[model samples]
Target: MKFLLTSGGIMNKSIHDALVGMLGKPIADCNALCIPTAMYGHPWVGPGVKAWEFISGKEENPMVNLGWKSVGVLELTALPSIDENRWKPLIQETDVLLVSGGDALYLCHWMRQSGMADLLLSLNAVYVGMSAGSMVMAPNIGEYFVGWTPPDGSDVTLGLVDFSIFPHLDHEMLPGNTLAAAQRWASGMRGPAYAMDDQTAIKVIDGVVEVVSEGHWKLFKP
Candidate 1:
């Protein structure tokens, strides 16, 4: 699986270009599935209008609004009740998965429960993760970002990538998300990590990682 992990969605041209490059085709030619499960787990994000905005392409973040050939919702929370045969092929046939931001641990829980975590390794599709969606790929999200906790009460996640991410670095709305705060967060990570702004994205293809940014980002080493 290829990854285009963003602090925000494809917020800038560079990130958009990186996504298109990963797809090897125009956005209009590809089929996509937007996962909104994470939003429900977040208190500030929702089980309401915010989730609807994301799915309907009305959200400020650019995931579902990219004008793909087709866009469908793949709510992870609802997957466990249905037959795998019904959804597995939909995922395999889709060109990309647009995962939304919310609570990383909560998203991780559903991803595991829904069996999407296991299936991810075998898929050929590109994965576009926003905020917590991107964070869920790391080994751990660190204590600071833990919003919704899993039953086992671990900050650990999918570990799909070698490094952790500190997203939305210095955004105005998140006044507390300064570089200094990120430094403090990085110290606890005890591994390689990145602090990226909304305009930045980290692209991974065949195990090679590259920073695609129009804004600013910093890589911290442990």
Candidate 2:
């Protein structure tokens, strides 16, 4: 599986090329299944949450607007009531699983409960993640900025990657998510971690990892 985990969506030509390279097909031929469950953590609250709401409401999603022929929305929050026969085929036919950002813990919870996490690994597709989308693919997001709600039991993620990912380093709107603060969090992390600004992305193809950045990023070790 290939994962293009970005702090934000594809923000530049380099990032888009990295994505297209991984997709291995014409941009117009790529079919996407977008999962926006993470954005549900504090639905209807906070600046970030409200902003995401407006974006998703728009007819042309940023991901699809890039050139994908079609985007099928799979509200994982509604997974419990959906028909497997209908949705499973959609998953198999899709060329990409595009996950948007929100609350990492919330997304992971529904993913596990609804079996999305397991279903995804079985496919050979490009997993495009933005913000919290990138965070949920990690083993854990150890004390990331603060105020992130914990899961019912553990703070575990999808474990799609071994290392932790810290996004939005030094973001003006998110003052808590700064370089100095991320370093402090990294110092306490038990394993390796990477911190990135919105213009950066962590690409993992098979087991190899690469940093694709248009702005700034850093790696931290215990």
Candidate 3:
């Protein structure tokens, strides 16, 4: 699987270009599925208008709003009740998966429960993740970002990537997300980590990772 991990969803031309490059086609020609499960788990974002906005392409993030050939919702929380045969093929056939931001641990839980986590490694489609969506790919989100804890009550995530991520770095609205805060977060990670602004994204294809940014980012290594 290919990854286009962003703090914000394709917020800038560089990130957009990286996504297009990964697709190997124009956005208008591809079919997409937007996963809005994470939003429901977040206290500040869910069970209301916010989820509707993300699905309807009314959110500030440039995700579902992208002109795709088709866009469908793949709510992870609801997948357990349905038959796998009904949804597995749909995922395999989709060109990309647009994942929304919320609680990383919550998203990780559903991803596991829904079997999306297992299926992801075998897919050929691109994955576009925003904020928590991106962080869920890391080995761990660190204690600072933990919310909606799993059964084991650990900060661990999917570990799809080798490094962790500190998203929305220094955003005016999230004053606690300063570089210093990210550095402190990284110290606890005990591994490689990235601090990225909204205009930045990390691209991973065939195990090679590259930073695609129009804003600022820093990489901290243990």
RMSD per candidate (Å) reads 0.6, 2.7, 0.6
Tens-digit lDDT string for candidate 2 (137-159): 88888765334566455677888
- Point out where model 3 deviates above 4 Å: none
Query: Which residue runs does candidate 1 get wrong by more than 4 Å?
Result: none
| Cα lDDT tens digits for candidate 1, 6-60 | 9999999999999999999999999999999899999989899999999999999
TM-score of each: 0.99, 0.90, 0.99
TM-score of 3: 0.99
lDDT of 2: 0.79
Task: Quote the RMSD, in angstroms, for model 1.
Answer: 0.6
Q: Against the correct fold, how does model 2 do in TM-score?
A: 0.90
lDDT (tens digit, per residue) of candidate 3 on 131-156? 99999999999999987979999999
Between candidates 2 and 3, the TM-score winner? 3
After best superposition, candidate 2 residue 113: deviation in angstroms? 0.8
